[model samples]
Target: MKHTMLAVLLAVVMAPGLALAHSEARPGAPADGETLSAPPEVVRLNFGGPMRITVLKLVGPAGEVPLARTDGMQPVTTLEARPEGELGAGAYEIEWRGMGADGHIMEGTVDFQIEP
Candidate 1:
């Protein structure tokens, strides 16, 4: 009975960490709902854990913008990208998918606007 109680206590203590194992993006550049005076040259994504970007995209009013690029497997907690072309004042959505060290796929989006 003592052993069982100890096991339950241990499980309860570790549950939160397990639940948070999945990587999640922290506050990123041009944070969601943020309005920028000038377009950001580079967008920075900060994750909770080391991650390898699998898919990244920037969608604007015009259409999909080819802004983000990665050479190869780069396991990093932060990923930075410089857009390919000039961005005009408008709303943009930054979408991303990444793989964490735990081998789980995590994805999310950040939306912001540029006001000139």
Candidate 2:
């Protein structure tokens, strides 16, 4: 009973720290729900922790747009991406998959719009 109680206490104490380890994108460029009169030349994803992006894509009104990954893609705090062509006025979504510093695979999406 004593051993079991100790284990439970440890688990409770560690849970919050484990939860904070999950990487999350915060304050992204072309932030969620933002509307712009002109398209942004580049998109920036800022994370709360270090991460390595493996896949990044952009889906626009016309369809999936070609996204080129820029530098700063290592296990840094940010990842940069740019579209191959100019984006017309419309809604767009940026999807990304990556490995967190904790060795966990994580994915996220950001949605925004280009105003007409």
Candidate 3:
């Protein structure tokens, strides 16, 4: 009987911690609803798991600018790039594909624009 009691107590303590470990992108990226003026220097992907970014693309005037891995970050979940060059003005679409430590590839986008 004592052993069973101890096992029950142990499980009660560990259950909550396990739940917090797996994080989710709530609502959506660019966080469901967010506004911007000019295209963000870098498209940020914030997630609960450590995600591996596989693709990045920015579509705007002139043509589709492939957003380099270096969008707006040096390290630790940052894209190391900036919106530059002769890219024309207009709303831009930022698309990205990546994987999480959970072994799942999650892709999303956020649209921030440049005014006329």
Whole-model Cα lDDT of every candidate shown, in order: 0.88, 0.88, 0.59
Those runs of model 3 whose alpha carbons end farther than 4 Å from true positions after fitting are: 1-23, 26-40, 71-76
Please write out the lDDT profile of model 3 over residues 1-116, one tens digit for every residue.
Answer: 99999999999998897665543553433443455544455555666655566677777766787655643322224444455554555766777776656456577777665655
lDDT (10s digit) by residue, model 1, range 1-116: 99999999999999998878877789999898899999898988898888999898999887888775553658888888889877898999999998988899989899999996
Q: State model 2's lDDT.
A: 0.88
Model 1 segments beyond 4 Å from truth?
1-14, 68-71
True-structure Cα RMSD, model 1: 2.5
48: Cα error in model 1, Å: 1.5
Q: For candidate 2, lDDT tens digit of each residue in 1-116?
A: 99999999999999999999988878889899999989999998998899899888999989998978765567868887788977999999999889998899988899999999
Q: Which lDDT value does model 2 have at 95?
A: 92
- The order of the candidates by lDDT, greatest first, is 2, 1, 3
Q: Residue 77's C-alpha lDDT in candidate 2?
A: 82
Error of 1 at 70 (Å): 5.2
Off by over 4 Å in 2: none
Candidate 3 versus the native: TM-score? 0.58
